[model samples]
Every structure is written in structure tokens, then in C-alpha cells.
Target chain A: MNIGILLKEGPYNHQASDTAYKFAEAAIKKGHTIDAVFFYNDGVNNSTGNMEPPQDDRHIGNRWVGLCQKNNVKMMVCIAAAKRRGINDDVLIDCGEITGLGNLTDIAIRNDRLVTFGD
Target chain B: MEEFDDDEIVKKIMHVMRNAPHGTIYTYEGLEMILIMAAYDQDISVAFVDDGVYALKKGQDTAGIEVKGFAKTFLALDGYDVEKLYVDQVSLEERGLTEDDLVVDVEVISSAEIGKMMTEQDVVIQH
Candidate 1:
């Protein structure tokens, strides 16, 4: 199955990012394809590469990048939503690509399921 | 509210509105999404709850704020064939508003009714 995950909350403040990551990992382990992980609203903050949490904490941003690299999944941040939150290409993670709503529509149409994780 | 069967071919996509407009981009962008989905002709429904009920209040003057006022866009949603706007009755009453205060016509139903409708959707996108 091809799944499109929409993460609509920011990191740390909510468990949405953690939940999305676990779900994606589990789906990939089950041999399901994660067609795309689209970030909207505050969720676009996950694309920021400059996050500096405590050394003991998990590098949430890098985790998303690693997931995309390992699974060859598209990590998309809604350009409009990102812009509103001051997240741009300069700050986006290595695997993150800024996209539009049309791409989300395509993901929803092409994928067998569209699951969203939000606060 | 339209009913669907177990074998229905139509995809039910519900756009959830949970925040106030202008203060944050969620409601505005959610509306943008619904507009695009309107062209897709999918079965779409929007539920306004919590602080989201403020998006439909009448006589919103944003001249001081300088942002583009989009409350009027709710009035045009019907033209896009994106009807089925559900407003939570508890949210409205708690906010001291009634159907007459909203800019557009919406079915003010209980949260229980809306919750049941949510479980029936193929996809629920919250903003």
C-alpha cells in the first residue's frame, strides 16, 4: 500500500511528529510504501535543519531526513504553510522539498491511504 | 448531511477547521485546500469547532490588521459545490454566538453528531 502522511504539528511541543515517525517506520517495515510525508501548518517546522536540542535528545529533524533517505520517500513541506511559519529552502533539511497544495492533491489521489497526524 | 453506503465509490474527505482565522494561517490555508478539492469533486465536509467557530463571525473589520480579509470566502464555498459546512453547536453557544451571527449558512449540530461523521470519513485533514 502507498500511504501519504500529513503531519500538521510542530516538533517537541506535540507528540504528533513522534507519532508520525513511528507510524512511517512501522509502515516501511511492513513493506508498505510511504509515497510522501507532507507537512502543513506548524508541521512544516519539522523541515528546519538548524534545530539544536539537548545532546541527549533525539534529533527529530534528522530522523525525518533519514526516513526519506532510507525509504526513498518524498518529504514535502507545504510552501504556503512553510512561508507563513518562516521556514524556507535555506532552513529545510537535506531531503525536504517545498511543494504546493496541488502536490498534496496528487498524493491523496495516487495513494491508497492519506493519514494525518496533528495536535 | 448526505449518507453513503458501504460500497460507495465516492471518497469522503473532511477538512477540519480548529483555529481562528487571521491569527493563524490554518483556517485560511484550510479554505484554500477546500477550494482546490472542490475542483476534484470529492465528497468534502468542513467542521468548525473550538476556536474555529470565530472564522464565520459577521462584521469582521480587518482594516487595522492589514491582512487580507477572507471571512467572506465562506459565502462563496457553496458556489464551488463544497457545501456541508458543519458548525459545532456547543462551540457556538459557548462563544455566545448563534446561527444568525455567522456569515454563511451552516448546519449547527452537536459535537456528538460531528464526531460520528468524522469516523466515517476516508480522510480527515485537520488545520
Candidate 2:
């Protein structure tokens, strides 16, 4: 099955992002293909490649990027949402980058299932 | 991959358009996400009721506070194949608004019609 996961928050303040990753990993183990992972609202912060974690903390951003890279999943952050949250490739924040909703729409149009986890 | 019947699979997306005096970034964001999801499945319908009607309202001024341009993006739903846009009649009446107040071309229906539409989907996401 092709599944699209929507993560609407980052890890530091919400659990939705973490929950989405866990589900993604499990789904892949079950042989499901993660067509895309789209971020909206505050969730767009997950795409900042410049996230900073303390020495004692987990690299949450890296984890999400790694998961998508490992699984060949398309990580999409809503352009409008990302800009509002001040997250984009040119802005210099951390895990992900700016992407158009067109990217998200493409994934949605092709995926068999669309599941969103938000707070 | 396991084969499944398309008829057996249903997709339902409920959009929450909060037009509160303070405005809600999350609500609009949620709708955008649902729109992306609906664009993928032909069966997906986006229903906006209550405060959700504000989502399609034009002339938003959420500047200086860092809110995104949602109304503009919302106008692109039809190109994505998301043809079903619903607005509740009661919601509009309560707010003293009419179809002219909205930014998009929506099908204004009663709450009952919205309920019936929900029954057709396999999953429902209410933002």
C-alpha cells in the first residue's frame, strides 16, 4: 500500500511528529510504501535542516530526515506553512526545506492512503 | 501488494475553517493538508461547516504575526481535482454572512447534507 503521512508539528513541543515517524517505520516494516510525508502549520518546522539539539537530547530533526532518506519517502513541507513558521532552505533553521503544496498534492493524488497526525 | 477494492476504500476530509477574531493558523494549516490528501483520491470530499467557513474568506490580513497566505492557496483546490467544497447554511446565518462573504465558489448546504456526506467516507479528519 502507498501511504501518505501528514506531520503537523515538530518534536520539541508536540508528539504528533514523533508518532508519525513511529508509524512510518512500522508501516515500512510491514511492507507498506510511504509515498510522502507532508508538513503543515507548525509541523512545517520539521523541515528545518538547522535544528539544534542539546548534547543530552535526541536529534529529532535528523531522525525524520534519516527516516525519509532511508525509505525513499518524499518529505514535503507546505510552502505557505513553512514560510509562516519561518522555516525554509534559504532561512537557515534546521531539518527540512521549503516545498510547494503542489508537491503535497502530487503525493496525495498517487497515494492509496492519507493519514495525518497533528496536535 | 495486497489488492483491495476501490469501492471498499472511502476517503473523507472535514475542513475546519476558523474565522475567529484572533484567527487560527492551525485550522487553516489542517485544511491545506486535507486538500493535499483529497487531491490524491477522487472520492475525497472537503466539508466546511461552522467556523470552518472562514477558511475560504477573502481579504485576510494576518500580517506582522507570521501567518501564511492560505486563501490564495485554497483557490487552487479545483486544479487538484478537489471539487466538493461545502459550507453550512446555519454557520453562515449565525455569523450574519452570506455567500458573497466567502472567497470561493462553494456549495451551501444544510447541516443534514453535511452529515449524509460524512457517511460516504471510510475515514474522516475533522480539523
Give the winner by lDDT. Answer: 1
Q: What are the per-residue Cα lDDT tens digits for candidate 2 across B1-127?
A: 1225863333344554444423655666566566656644546567777777776777887787676666767677778777778888998898788999888888999999888877655445556
Best by TM-score: 1
Worst lDDT 10-window in candidate 1 chain A: A103-112
- Given candidate 2, what's the lDDT at residue A107? 53
Candidate 1 per-residue lDDT over residues A3-108, each given as its tens digit: 9999988999999999999999999999999999999878999999999999999999999999989899899999988888899999999999999887887777
* Residue range with the least summed lDDT across 10 consecutive positions in model 2 chain A: A88-97
Q: Look at candidate 1 and give me any clashing residue pairs.
A: none
Model 2 quality (TM-score): 0.66
- Identify the runs in model 1 with alpha carbons over 4 angstroms from their true place: B1-10, B64-67
- Give each model a TM-score: 0.86, 0.66
Q: What's the CA error at residue B25 for candidate 2, in Å?
A: 2.0
Tens digits of lDDT, candidate 2, A16-91: 9888988999999999998888887777777776778897987777877788668887777778876767665774
Evaluate candidate 2 and give its CAPRI docking class based on DockQ. incorrect
Chain B TM-score for the candidates in order: 0.92, 0.78
